[model samples]
Target: MTSISTTSSPATPTTVASAASKRVADRIAARAGDPDITLRERVALRTSDAEVTYAELSERAQKTAAELSALGVGAGDIVGVRLPSGPGAVAAMLACWHVGAAFLPMDASAPDAHRDHLLSRSAARAVIDGDGPRSLTDAAPSATGSPKGDDAYVIYTSGSTGTPKGVLVGQDAFAEHTTAIADLLELRDTDTVLQFAGLGFDVAQEEIWPTLAVGGTVAFLDSKDRALGPAELARRVRELNVSVLQLPTSYWRLLCAQMRGTESPGLSFDGVRTVVIGGEAAGTKDVHAHRDGPLGHCTLVNGYGPTETVVTCTAFVLRAHEPLPPTAGLPIGGPVGERRLYVLGADRRPAAGDSPGELWVGGSPLAEGYLNDPQRTAERFHADPFGSASGARMYRTGDLVRRHRDGTLEFLGRLDNQVKVRGYRIELDEVERHLTDTRGVTAAAAVALDDGTGTGGRILAAALAVTAGGPTAEEIREDLRGRLPSHLVPGLIRVRDALPLTTSGKIDRKAVAAVLADEHTAGEEAGAGVRVRADADAASAGIAAADTADADLTLLLKLIRTLLRAPDFGPDDDFLAHGGDSLVALRVSGTLREHGLRLRPSDLLTAQDARAAAVRMERS
Candidate 1:
């Protein structure tokens, strides 16, 4: 049986051994002697604090590499990097590559235990944080024994068993993937690409490596800009002349709404030539809006791949001149570069025509495997029996997809309990495990529910079976906040005596989700009632304090109520307590800006309630 190749161009006969072996750092180094002086001196990194040119960046990387070598870091070693997203972080990564060591990216904000776990598991030789590089282990370097010598990086993703698993990507695969992405996006030396994804994510590699490999500028969003709403983000992109934008689909949907809204005066993607959206399905409405709106000239791409595939393996490019697909949802199109995608059935054969099957990704872009976990590596990465190449393996994505008649793949839902929420891949069982471990929780089931905002956004919600006289829902959420990452924490938690169960004695997740949805709807209705009463009270007062600070508080409360869909609450009420998440906060801030007010999402999140937010707005 022969494997199907889904690339638009014929699959080139390239083996993993024959893939590009030049490191991304080496590629950037080679750009120094370019005939175009402007290209040689192009801005490699742009942060709010400073802009570093390609030559300067290269010098920093060399210095950092020397520092790492002094710490006895060498080929096949893993160096843990714990730094905030900035020039320093990128330089640290390049330094690891220069020393022929694999870089293990650790989130600067991650809990100490999480960081410790990753370090212990990866057996990192050194650590780099704000204080700079320090040796973590005195042991000698462990040879990876790969033809590629060392790995480029190892990124951890959410695992089902309550622990994150690290995916090891070889340098050859990394170089090939980044080069392919640069070509696919047609990135030029003059382009400025926005570095949006977190440093810990594989998408960050895509954002940084591809642009740098092509001598393009990689713009980093500062803390303030990172929290900006869609409108503000669009304005920032325009201000920076960002020509390429890679955003999560959920945020892209919001940005699309902002572009189509009447209040967004200067919100535009005027200079953006390409916009890549992934980590979740693209909404058809947003796709059509971008096609028909002012951004009609920009190329919109829907990229699809798991972390194991080294960022993106298949991309559905919606060029401005091409006709939009008639399907309801956008297709996750053909393979990029030397990558291969197959839709195989239960028998490990190609699925019958139009039949949905599991997505299996192969070729040079596939990662080596999960770090130090052979069981998982073996289970997910299977030998490619259909391929003629010896020892070629394909990753079983566990994503249900169907190859369209036109050869593009349309994503169905996941076959497992894993879900992508707001660009973060989460495992329900992992959340459930943490929930049950919480004090006073006997059982738990976490589920993703539509946020009801009509923006194609989903929020994490959990149903818990608590002990008698256990902690309140708010208390449980507070406990979870300390344990899980912010995104993993449930926005809405429902505590009940018992959870709904199926006849097979398993937790009925669907039933729980339905019940939670009903409760959410009821809460919104009650919030509407409170809003009406608040309006009535203000109207009955007859504009007596219409021009005062009290009036501003009322307006802020109204906006908050509308965004949260919750009933009116006191000045001390918490925004997050009323089902507000970061996305909702962005919308609130953006809407408030249109009303001649300025409040960052961070400010609103920190403010106790609507009244406090209004006060903060006044101070600003």
Candidate 2:
């Protein structure tokens, strides 16, 4: 019931909910059937294998809608989408909107238990996965008609209770948010926006909906391309002629590093006009690096918002040749569109002057609250005392920030244990809960430790107290891999007789982090010794049966050790086993390319170890 004010036009009328719900889908359909051949024939979606025109995408959506209708899905029904990031996934989402049904995006790679829990909790009527649409329930569909104010989509985020909570966003909010972003980015029919985020992430909506609403092409990278390092990613961007990029702050840092690196000092963001970075605080150093590096010609925007506010509510746009703001770090600029920002202090009143306070977001961007969880809904979403409109509510984002004299916001920190690592929001308590639930685990503590490479990357680490004769740390880690997502699992796990406690009797997270850091250092030293001994033995034995193969293996081992920061990594050591993840694999590929060798992330992941990967490289 609140109105948002935009620069190009007045605020959307409060009574536009029903009309707004139909605007996005209606606009896309109109473009598909337009008399102008250019509009209808324009590329709307691009995958590795094919490019779909606006008309083709519309037809696919219509067919998928019919399939959903046959499965008893209609207005008010929630459908789970588990497809990968491709044309099929985009069509499935459009189909839900066409049939007046809301959708819940689920990760295709998530464990069965996790997926089942979401399906059961959201009461999804049907699910569309690789096998296509199938009924998940036998209930009758709601009467067919306009969806009106029905919920648009549900996105689940990590919860402190160890269960993911679904945030229910209505059709009006989704439309308003996407339209605002399209306006902010000045998206056009010729612009190609890269679809980089996972389907389940809220950022994915920003990538897909806004582009379609403006008739721009949404380019999706294949798995191999998606895992590319900054140098290779820049090349892919040029090949696709991508004009826009929405990257996480962590990955953006990597891009900055690549541009400044001696190996690829000229790696360029050639065709990209705008780069949006969010999901974590942007550091001052990274901003300066981008400004002074090859990406200086492109616009850099620092976006900020919680999932409850629909991807991003505020943005700080820094254009080419503009001087940096005088703030310590990049400021998260004023609210975008009609959304309003409120910096409330401990007394629940607007913070005076430049004082820090909790950020509260209001207006059309506010979500309907958590699905099927009234207690949480009431706790976070409250009536807006600052708004003049009756029934207007605001979402209380637990992030702490300060308001500058120019109305821009500077991020300080968090009010809770929520941490963002590699753009993923994680609750430390949720990770600890899973650890304690593991077999033979008595107590557990989770902390975000610095990666120690001065790269601003944080590693998720856990320290646990296990019973006598319980599973080893490796076994516990393996078990966790089956239960949690790769990003949620701790990179380093330590077993202790008992976790250190603070003076107040709470878990001493600082002390535990110290122990883990020390152990990490010791391991690297021991690994160096082992590498020296192995090299000596090879020299003494005159093991030169395969000179080329040995040299390849040696180079592979060195790269693995340097990238993973595991100096003990050997020719037979598994890359993943030594804390290598997809990001690291991308770096591996980029480094290998520098040496006149090539390997995709999938290729590295499938190989048995460094030795096997070297052998495969040799064959190629």
Candidate 3:
């Protein structure tokens, strides 16, 4: 799946703003060449029951916008949007855009703790919900005409560093980048774009505005239906005649699974134009391969971008036989029209050709800064060393990239405390945040170590002291399950007597990694550890053999060790005295699944300890 690009080749694209509205909308109108056009595209949505039109979408967006205004939502006010993807989420986004308000989208599926942190951190004037936030304010003056920069909104990332930080994107930034996307992709009014990515995800920016701005139609797929598998997705695409499809690499894998020779096994993009794969690298191998099959007539572009920049900093189309070089893809093409990019080195020196450097994004599309957190803003958004003659500020991407011998750019790797897991960038602090939230926890710390994934080992937590009724390792994990996405959660939760800190008072990550290495090595007495004649317990032994009795004893031992989180606890350990939690019990059950074992995530939590849990597992 190594498909990240090194540099952006596209120059920034800009368009003259109309007398009213916002920059993104303005750019779309100009490119569309038809202000009178009611819908962005000419596609119709169909299903077993009925057919839908863009007019319906317009009515809903307009209605929602009007409703929001009555609720005191004005241009520029930070609105924390945490909701699922569907017609409601789509309408809310367009409604926000229609009135020229900035958008701040958060993943609705995240844990409550994460959501609470985001809302508080962003200090959003208002938070949008289909059911409305628990609190509300009186109506404010309704904006009648165009929106200004001060009125624009910004979306915040689920701060993996500890809390969420808002990325302030305004009307101008949206317009600047999208206009180039339209030109680069040749998006037209006849195209129907499917909005599959979560509003919290950047792919929405690429999927939503480009189509709507061009007077093209946008279709919001229901999340429920979205999980129905690829065959069903093909039906929706063909029925809607979706011309432009943009999806995250995760979703692409599922979609690709259902696809057959150059086309979907049961369907084809008869009217589709382009298929966009972005957010994360779409493995160069997949891109090069899928370019021709069912994609027959469609153009396939593997794009790249980071959270700090506008939607996309760069992109490259996969051409037959002329695939991207091994380093990554070509640079984002010449400022698609209004924006520009600079590859700066460690000292912020603009790197020469093929020279690696930090990616600094500048131009009119830049964000003002992080919401509420000035220190972070100062660190990331630096002054224009070239001078403020252009009033241009650049965001340090922390991504190592370089220019190609040609004009294209290539991605190197990360230079900071960030790493991507299952396509999501995670900060070690975010993991610590969730751990500290657990009861009985005094101080928690995490570190990324050597793991199979290229990003590094990842943030694993260790609690130094336990508060009265302090949480167990499993409790911390379960807590995170509700606040962060699964991928952001650590693969292992190590309970320690205490965390090690440096002279500077920061968590000693090195000390934590050492613990992790010891834990994995000590616990893994891998292979056939015991002679189990029965198919019973293999939990404690970390050993599995074909013989039933041999596996049973091993499973029992493994379950006890896992539930206890005590390296020396052994198979005879008393689960309760060992401090077992529900999550640890669940792990015991999950391990069974690896060898065809299944117990509920709460299995161990209900039991007193390993022996009892083993009894339950054996019974089940």
Ranking of candidates on lDDT, top first: 1, 2, 3
| Candidate 3 Cα outliers beyond 4 Å, as residue runs | 1-52, 98-100, 132-135, 138-151, 158-161, 225-236, 250-264, 267-273, 281-283, 286-298, 328-336, 387-389, 448-469, 485-487, 499-506, 514-620
- Candidate 2: where are CA atoms >4 Å away? 1-12, 15-22, 138-149, 261-268, 503-505, 520-548, 558-570, 589-602, 616-620
Q: RMSD of each candidate?
A: 3.6, 4.0, 7.7
Over 530-614, each residue of candidate 1 has an lDDT whose tens digit, in order, gives 5566556455434334566766666667667665655444456778666666677778776777777777787787777766787
Name the candidate, 2 or 3, with the larger lDDT value: 2
- Off-target runs (Cα >4 Å) in candidate 1 are 1-5, 8-18, 33-39, 137-149, 261-265, 292-294, 535-547, 558-569, 576-579, 593-598, 618-620
Query: What residue pairs are clashing in model 2?
Result: 4-338, 5-338
Per-candidate TM equals 0.91, 0.90, 0.72
Best of the candidates, TM-score: 1
lDDT values of the candidates? 0.79, 0.79, 0.58
* TM-score, candidate number 2: 0.90
Candidate 3 per-residue lDDT over residues 143-255, each given as its tens digit: 21223524345666646467767777655666666776887788887778887776677767677777766666677665444243344556778776687888665455434
- Order by TM-score, highest first: 1, 2, 3
